[model samples]
Target: MKLSVSDSDLLGLVHLIRLYGKNLSKTWSYTITHLIRKIHDQEHFPVTDMVKKELNADSLNKYQRQKLNRRLENDSLMIEHMIAVQSIINVIMKFQYSKNDNDAIRELRSILEANTNCIIKFAIKEKDLKGI
Candidate 1:
């Protein structure tokens, strides 16, 4: 399947988080929150308030929020990611899927890995997954 540079970059950013970024405090803080929400929303499971704090955009600072919003706005890849991720979330939330389910995730991982160079960078400096 073909992907635009922006889409590839967004996927790479996600992959970077799954790899190096997964262990970082910030990554866990943010990703887990997003993950939980995705999982809950997709799986129809309930998440605690504490978990919500992690992914909540309102919890982010002005700069971080601005950066994230810009990244989402400017990147077509990110938009695609949102579409795909949300679909995954919807399936999971409906109880038709589970977190242990790997089909969609694996497929996405493969696609992103295949296009690593195009899939990971954002205009923001901190969003850059190069060193990590």
Candidate 2:
């Protein structure tokens, strides 16, 4: 399939990979942990009464487990993410090693085409891509 990846999206993936390497789950874990800490010690997560009341009903451990089940998103998707990251990194290496611009572009386009779905998922889900 012919996939059109915008330069900005490509840059975003590059940025994300630099921050988290091949592990996108670290970003998800950090975000959840940060919120949990705010809710527990700081009591600053849900300043409003309604949200706080809702959360008060559930134990923090249970809440964290639920979040992990949802965010981990199973091993298959995570493996795809890892593969996609490595493929993109390979393209970067190609550009670095090869003096021929055309050769590098061809290699990049090939990798992007082969891993279109995973690459797009990475580019689009910038919300979960964060620094630890």
Candidate 3:
């Protein structure tokens, strides 16, 4: 299948490969989440005004609003992004740890594709891509 990857996604993949090298584990949720959040903060995009409006509204409970605000302020989608990644990571890691090399590689490819899809959605929203 054809994969559509953005520049940011390519950079992230390259960074991940460099960080883990051949020693990469299929289960890299913890480290990857930390890295994603750090990178997002360093980039420092202001939270969308919509996010602030949502936070200001009373529709969300106090706890939920606070959590939402924190996430928005950081401009990091760690909570949702990590959730998307973990399941795929688990599937690939299981196959790898079981010595199923072919299946492991296939699953890894699927995981990467899924991640690219997520990043595309995020970039479209974050950059406010037209006609999206």
Candidate 4:
């Protein structure tokens, strides 16, 4: 599906990439790069060559580089899963901010609670597959 995010959400995601792109673990940095490409259609947020160069610096050991390269090779699936997880997080955040009298919050809370077990199962499966 083609997903469209708000400007604020896009900026928030970009800020996250900028803030933690270089500092994250190798796996996470690769994931973040996939997210950046998904959202911005470039390997780096803000589409800057300098940021791309920094992110792709030759600092990784052979194994780490291989892992990162593997993730990059499967970028489409990584982006899809990241987007799905990010959507769930956004919904949870929205529910958290709902007003006390909001009926939508009650409904959403019930839906989320009902799906918690299924979500946990999926998470476990993903963890087993990716060791994440």
Candidate 5:
């Protein structure tokens, strides 16, 4: 689906990535985790609390199971948004960490732009234009 991300959301993401890059001493895993948490924290979905409860449950009642399943579908869709952004960042980081290869940088830039567009498309697909 063609998702359309808002200008603010796009700028926010770019700013976040740049901020994270300032701390180059951090590992990629740590940076990605922080980014994911930041993204997840910025949005509030009513079903999120229930989903968390269901996740922690030892056994789900029929109603809870059904509700959790429905909510999870939405959650998974949002997760795709996160994954798309993370993937793009990962590619960009790889380029940054690599030897200065113009060819590699060009290839990575193409991939990053494509993935960034995908994230924007996913954002547009969301019921509310609030990005991931």
Candidate 6:
């Protein structure tokens, strides 16, 4: 499957790669390089957000608010969870799709992806995987 990114979003990714190259994987670096080369090849294809277009704010009622308050008060458990997620990712990332990386990636991606207007999405072709 092919994915297209906007000049605005592409510039954002370029900025992130510039600031955090050490944290990014080779697959990401290689893909971003390709994206940069293909920037001029862009078409005006409108991309949609990967999230629900509308959210029901009515769900945030009294009970939900109370539960949220309790969760915020539970610092020890949250800290332990953070530590576990940190260990899950490792000092240097080995693989981004392993079981150990799942929870860490899920939580971080949940927040970031949820907030993204439109994200750059891609699948590494099998032939290119080994090289990355």
Residues 1-132, model 2: lDDT tens digits: 354444444444434434454454756445433432232231111112322253342222334434434754422111113233434444543443233444444554565555433211122233353221
For candidate 3, give the lDDT: 0.40
lDDT (tens digit, per residue) of candidate 1 on 1-132? 232224343444455445444245664545634753332222111222332343342223223434555646433111112224434433332322123324434554444333222122233432433221
| Model 5 lDDT per residue over 1-132, tens place | 212333444444444445566565557556655654454334332333333454654333334444555765444323324335556566655544333344444444354445532121121234454334
Screening candidate 5 with a backbone cut-off below 3 angstroms (N, C-alpha, C), the clashing residue pairs are 3-120, 3-121
* Top-scoring candidate (lDDT): 5
The per-model lDDT (C-alpha) reads: 0.35, 0.36, 0.40, 0.36, 0.43, 0.33
Instruction: Encode model 3's per-residue lDDT on 11-103: one tens digit a residue.
Output: 554455445645766465566655444433333222334544544432232244346547664443221232344454443334432134444
Give the backbone clash total of model 1. 13
Better of 5 and 6 by TM-score: 5
Off by over 4 Å in 4: 25-132
The C-alpha TM-scores of every prediction are 0.21, 0.27, 0.27, 0.22, 0.30, 0.22
lDDT of predicted model 1:
0.35
RMSD (Å) per prediction: 16.2, 15.7, 12.0, 16.6, 12.9, 17.7
Per residue, candidate 4 scores C-alpha lDDT tens digits across 1-94 of: 2223344544444445445545556676556445433442322112123313534542322244345556553221111133344444344334
Where is the poorest 10-residue window by lDDT in model 3?
A: 116-125
Least accurate 10 contiguous residues by lDDT in model 1: 39-48
Q: Could you tell me how far off, in angstroms, the CA of residue 51 lies in candidate 6 after the best superposition?
A: 46
Judged by lDDT relative to the true structure, which candidate is superior, 1 or 6?
1
Off by over 4 Å in 6: 1-7, 42-132
- Tell me how many clashing residue pairs each candidate has: 13, 0, 0, 0, 2, 0
Ranking by lDDT: 5, 3, 2, 4, 1, 6
lDDT of 3 at 88: 43
* Collision pairs in model 3: none
Better of 1 and 6 by TM-score: 6
